[model samples]
Structure formats: C-alpha cells, structure tokens
Target: MTALPRNVPSSTDPHHLPGVRWLRSSYSTGANNCVETTRPAAGPWAGLLAVRDSKDPAGPALLFSPESWSGFTAAFH
Candidate 1:
C-alpha cells in the first residue's frame, strides 16, 4: 500500500506554511475569533485544506480532505 503524506502542519507555526492564503468566513465577527482555511496550491500538502484558529495565525493548523470538509460543513447545515 502507498503511504499517505503528512497533510497537517508539523506545528501551530503559521510560518511553516509561508505563502498559503488563509481565508476566514464572511460571517466572522470583528472579534477575531474564528477559524481560517486555505488550500496549499503546491507542495506535498497540495489538495488538502488547512484550517487554523484566526486568533492565532501563527498557531498550528489541522488538515482535512475535500470530502471530509464537505461532510463537516454539511452536518452543520
């Protein structure tokens, strides 16, 4: 079987993902307490979505597959 690449960032350091464009939801309040997501356009992490806490842009991020992210949002809807 082929081994899967490590999609998640090694740490909560935003610097680890330099150049990634993190985007927060339009519904986010001005409080700056929301989660942001970005897709790695290139590299081993490409195709995976990265999510991080808006309060801590330099913090670690959690990676998810497109299908998983869709199911997650669907559950809330």
Candidate 2:
C-alpha cells in the first residue's frame, strides 16, 4: 500500500493540481486501457484519488475517496 501525497487542493475543478506525476504499468504498452495516478503533498484534496488515462493528461480525471478506491481495486483482484 502507498500513501497519498498531502498537497492536493480541494477542487473537483481539476486545475488546482500541478506537476502531477503520472505513472503507468509496464505491461500497459500499446493499450487503450492505460491508467495513471497521482497524489498531492498537502491540501483539502490530499489523500483523494486522482485517476486518469495515460493517453490523455488534459482529459477529465476520476476522483475517488480512499475507501472507494480500495473497494475498486479489490474488485479487480
């Protein structure tokens, strides 16, 4: 398990997060099914989930609560 960063701003607006470093699985090459995640180091949005597509950084992101993301990841396993 990894800890979310503490600097994310509380905005569903998606513009508050800057310098978001997205990472993709090594197995995701050439697939449209790519996903990425980032966390801020401090703010109201800290600890929130920022899920996005590797194909589109400027695209909309899916925000999730810690519990929600946990459940979501569990479902796949």
The 0-to-1 C-alpha lDDT of every candidate, in the order given, reads: 0.71, 0.63
Q: Which portions of model 1 show Cα errors greater than 4 Å?
A: 1-15
**Lowest-lDDT window of 10 residues in candidate 1?**
1-10
TM-score of every candidate: 0.77, 0.65
User: How much lDDT does candidate 1 score?
Assistant: 0.71
RMSD, model 1, all Cα superposed?
4.5
Residue 56 accuracy (lDDT) in model 2: 73
- Write candidate 1's Cα lDDT for 1-77 as tens digits: 12322345534354466468788978789798788888877666778878887887766777777877887778889
lDDT of 1 at 57: 73
**Model 2 lDDT per residue over 1-77, tens place:** 24432333333444566545666756687675788777655445567777777777666666677877787789888
